[model samples]
Target: MGCCTGRCTLIFLCTLQLLTSLERQIFDFLGYQWAPILGNFLHIIIIILGLFGTIQYRSKYIVVYSIWTALWVAWNVFIICFYLEVGGLSKDTDYMTFNISMHRSWWREHGPGCVRREVPPPTTRGLEDHAYISVTGCMVEFQYLEVMHSSLQILLALVGFVYACYVISVFTEEEDSFDFIGGLDSYTYHHSPQKTSHVQLKPVYLSK
Candidate 1:
């Protein structure tokens, strides 16, 4: 039971990490006006379910968790491929400029009073540059973290898959053992011959 508790904790943490990473990516995509919100929302729900299932130790939940993990793994692989295709981090060298442009465009289109009020330009060049630099650094760090999290998620999912399989095998073995014991007892009770007591003829004659 202690072992199971520990394993559940690990799984929960891994899932939480995956959730955080996904949320971060989703937020970034949303900022850029290109996020798949519904898919990400579904992923979040699946992770939550997995966490609940792990804590409760339910096989059905574990199965769901495993399936989601598998799908997440595939999604991560696809993302990695896409990232590479886009020339990886090197292509993001102009992240600050791109992000600023995206932010401006998004705010212009969606911000409150967009039609009534004009967007304000940066007041201080030095401060603006500094802020963009900081933002760019954070973006770089986030990108690296995203890759690391994806890799870690893959490992976690693999471990979870194996654990799920083990749990299933254990249940199967227990059922088989019970069935065998039950069948053996049933056969012994029904097939074995009954013993009978022999009567003494001498005793009967004396009585007469």
Candidate 2:
């Protein structure tokens, strides 16, 4: 398990890289404007950190893997919340503008300037609040496929974590009867009969 830790760590790092690459492609296609230098620098830093962690803590790779997994999960939650809150600036749902518009209209209609003003769109409130757009506008909308992909990553991370825990238990537990095959041979031979000696033939030869 220790020896395989490095490979597992690399797999997780590559998954992160793939996600970032997809984000980059989406941003480029949308002609989205971001702080190119800063974004690139951050990407580089992430890669460097992953590589450093892999090299320096290969035996304890589970620690790095857990950190990365947590970060990824947190990032997903952040994206979900940001989109749901920002209305038109949502990164996931497509009907944000329409919903925001209705919300703003309702707000403006009930306000102090009701006599002279129509309701503002819901997004108008976000703009009025001067909320920071952050990195959300550049986020790719979460489609069914994207959700499935992310779900698979989360599942894989969980499986790896569980396996790591099992390995830890195996190492810590003081049991000499560690069944390597664990009844696998029994499963293979399932209902087959056991071999027996032919004692009748030996008896006949002795009588002759």
User: Which candidate wins on lDDT?
Assistant: 1
lDDT tens digits, residue span 88-201, model 2 = 444433232333322211112222333332354446655465432212222233333334444554555455455545443443342323354556667557534332234434
Model 2 TM: 0.33
Total backbone clashes of model 2?
6
**lDDT tens digits by residue: candidate 1, 1-208:** 7446555654766566566657654554654523323445666777677667666655577677678778878876654544444545442333423444533112223333333334334665654443321121122334344455457757766776676666645545666798999999998887654322233223553554
> How high is each candidate's TM-score?
0.50, 0.33
Error of 2 at 70 (Å): 1.1
TM-score of 1: 0.50
Top TM-score prediction, candidate number: 1
**Where does candidate 2 stray beyond 4 Å?**
5-44, 55-65, 82-208
* Candidate 2: pairs in clash: 100-122, 104-120, 104-121, 104-122, 105-119, 105-120
